[model samples]
Target: MVSKVKIKINDLYKIFGPKGESHVEKVKSGMGKPELLEKHSHVLGLQNINLDIIEGKIQVIMGLSGSGKSTLIRHINRLIEPTAGQIFIDDTDVLAMSDEELMNFRRFKASMVFQKFALLPHRTVLANTIYGLTMQGLEVKEAEERAAHWLKRVGLEGFEDRYPAQLSGGMQQRVGLARALATDADILLMDEAFSALDPLIRSDMQEILLELQEELHKTIVFITHDLDEALRIGDDIAILRDGRLVQQGSSQDIVLNPADDYVGDFIKDINRARVLTLGTLPLKKASTKGIALSNNTSLENAMKALVDAKKDSVIVVKGDKKLGSVSMHDIVHAATRSSETAGEAVTYR
Candidate 1:
């Protein structure tokens, strides 16, 4: 079944300077970012970006510094107005919202989690979590009940009374997450939300997010510069460079079929075994009596299963229906192939 598109961005353009609108024509007329800056003294932040964000799926926007990744995310909530573009959330025009409508949208329809753990230093954890609910004029008892539930959900049940400075960085970020989740918004805007944590903590946070997503299925827009994180969490990824989109696709698609040399370099050193899945491998009609594996199983896990079971091939199935059989040779070849040669000989469905 095809998922519904929750957010649609069309012809998005952002330019920075006093006369940003004036330079939009030049940018649309084929002026590059460097030339625009050097000649017009205006910075081009984004150029003609078009994307569809699926409902209840995580869409990650990633790139190096100055790639306009953060800028693009902010546009979803209209924190930064575009030079020219249209943003549709559930087919409703976001760019056309009045100030009051936008304020209500931010308060009820979506919530943001920042990288810096933007908690109130003066308020207790419970108070901070209930901040948004209170802003919406919810009753004190109801707000507290909602905040307490989300705090416990994020593993901060016992830390409700502690101030932001009293907790470690990871704990503080958890508070920020709980606060965002407490609002019960349909859309979650995470702007490099876990980029500030240590490696292990970041992994833990990712797991937490995935677990919650399995239950809540909120429409998530996650921003990051780390390719590993993007592949691990994003249902779809959009890569940007110099204020323009480089590529956009699933993790397997990008890993196996990079759009260009720029995207290829980003994924060249990545471990293909972890990113590619059995469902992406070519399906064969030949049947096998080996062990059965789910179609979504990773190549890394499939290899381990094969070695443990002492089998040369395994049957890939979706539920009880068998899709095809994949041999050990095919798995190894797919995982070990160089990224530059990817999607050349192998055809992934």
Candidate 2:
């Protein structure tokens, strides 16, 4: 994890007020957000944000609206300068980079997908996708080849000649994705990229992103307000509240052990049976097994299989080898338990 870190943000802060800098010390001295705002008339957009974005993994920053999730992501590319902090990408000081250096970094090192599908309305899909490449002074022929390749990869093959208005909302977002991917940037900054799509379309886009990530391994920083979306797509999830990080860890860690009541309530409505996978369940020594199921199966599906087969327990297998066994009772109990509980374990084989 240490060696693979692609971006590190240290002691980041963003205060929105003319006198914001003066209030930094007050806020740091154990002042609550409400009190600070009331006394100083300043809004803290982010507070002491420290994060390690691992290479080739999705790091989701999620919270309700006004929680500073969006504010935190923009600091990566210096889209929104921080009041105080240091940002390092590949150990390069982003905050210290010159204008020309920042321009090159944005052109070649990072690409962004916005919630609004910020496509050029008049430009053809191919033209828009190739915009980044052309900015780098690549030849038109070479740029078109790369852009066309990514357009096809993102399922926009025949729509290359179509403008943004000619495409469906989902298709327009696909064009946006292709444009970002065409840049061949090491980091993908997706700010609620699929939130504007319909539910089914959003789900489809999520699957598409996951499929692409499996192959591309881009360092992704995804911003979302949806807990389900975060859990589904994020390899590491960071929860923010009132401009402060409440918790950060794997999805399983966050769900099984929420940092506080705020976080627990945030995930209270989540369907655990769907969110949890069999591999994350407690593993036990394989014993009397009625049916064998893959360790990667979802808890919901495993429960359904157990019910359909009239089995109390199922042996968990990875490949041909038995890994452990999990019982219907354990699954039910684990799924129903309050987030505050120290979750029960499934025995491992």
Report the number of the highest-TM-score candidate.
1
lDDT of model 1 at residue 173? 90
In the order shown, the candidates' Cα RMSDs to the true structure are 3.9, 5.2
lDDT (10s digit) by residue, model 1, range 94-132: 999999999999999989999998899999999999998
**TM-score list, all predictions:** 0.94, 0.91
Clashing pairs in 1: none
Q: Local error of candidate 1 at 58, Å?
A: 0.7
lDDT of all the models against the reference?
0.92, 0.90
